[model samples]
Target: MSIISLSSGVQNNLSIMPRWPATQVLIDSLAWQKLQAVQASLPGHLGLILTRAYEPRVSELGRARTAFRRAGICLFGLLYRHRKEEIQDIFGSNGHDLDGTHIDVSFSINGQRVRLLPLSVFTPMSWQARRIKKFDEELSMVLAALLAQGFQLHRNATESLQIHCDLKPVL
Candidate 1:
């Protein structure tokens, strides 16, 4: 399989994004455990990336990087700063909801943007719900896997959380 990669600059931009305000519940704990399980189950040759709306806890990032490294899977993190104006621009004037969950980051590979929709917003079943708690890490892995499968970020749409991408077959 072709290896997927992001430019160093994009990665850096993600690293500096502001983290979301703390929640009363420890939602990330479950997601982190799930990520660890997924990492453990992935093929030896597969790589992993952990993306989030904001920068991750240093310990979490360290653990992910170390675990993936030992398994010979490349790992990285992507984060973005959340901006209310940007959300208004994209989701329209009355887009804010009582739920704090919102788009805080965008991932670009080779100058292309990847479309990301909340799995919950699109799917009906609660099981299909996109866990906003794990949005960052989940997005990271999805983007990484897509890149590994030979896709690149395409564009950011004017309105909506969707990010578009171009896919190319591995030579």
Candidate 2:
């Protein structure tokens, strides 16, 4: 099983606390499309493992899991977020809890495990513009990187692109 790690950095200017605008088309369609594309490209049987942690709403987690299942993928592990005070309740060290250093999602394909870094921003206003741009850039980079590694894209009009390769694991 081959393991791949994709790392990305967020702009320091981008606020973690987002105040999304109401009329941000960039956040709504393009960002969502990019996210969907990335999620869809993930191989089935891998987990949506979390690297950097965050307080994801239960609904959002459920939706993500549902989307994975619907796409014939398996949900595996999670990385939980903790505040400074809550750090002791989870991990013992502040250094270990640093943001954007871990996987936000993980999965196994063809017996190989992969982790998705949690660099994609999620916020209400991100539904408007900023998040969408980030999403597009990130997804594009992911696609290009995968292609560079010899992964080929398979188009499926009935659904998302179905990746095909001899190494692809059986779901």
Candidate 3:
């Protein structure tokens, strides 16, 4: 488990809030450190799997399913709890919480715990843009898979949706 502490100056400078080049440097440095920690703990079989969407097609779905079968736990940097308005106010943008200048990755604390921590000091906007595209693409695949497996959109359904399949045919 890797822990990072920011310098007092950087931490205290929050009053001015996200001061250009200097703050960006610190953010990038922190991101690099966290990335190293994540790389150190990855399973041999998994290698470095960036959080990206697989295609919705059958072949891509099969490949994705196989990869997931080998994964025990998956941690993502998605900050879904915050509303879009809140994110816009903070970063002057109207997108996901992580679309800000700072890049954050899921930091694993132990075998069972994980937290989202900043990945980079002022990373390039292009990098952020590419990642967000991949993330959204992957989400689309998720929806595709859910619907392919017999799930439907329910506006306010109370009960849970349970899907069962007998593997005899595929086997």
TM-score of each: 0.23, 0.21, 0.19
Report the Cα lDDT for residue 81, model 1: 32
Q: Per-residue CA lDDT of candidate 1, range 38-116, in tens?
A: 3454444332333331222354643553353344211111111333224323322121121111223344333344334
lDDT of each: 0.33, 0.27, 0.26
RMSD of each: 18.0, 18.3, 20.8
lDDT of 2: 0.27
Quote the RMSD, in angstroms, for model 2.
18.3
Model 1 local distance difference test score:
0.33
Model 1, residue 167: C-alpha shift (Å): 1.5
Candidate 1 is scored at a TM of 0.23
Pairs with steric clashes in candidate 3 = 24-122, 27-120, 27-121, 28-120, 28-121, 31-119, 31-120, 53-138, 103-119
Task: Give the higher-TM-score candidate: 1 or 2.
Answer: 1
- Model 2: worst 10 consecutive residues (lDDT sum): 157-166
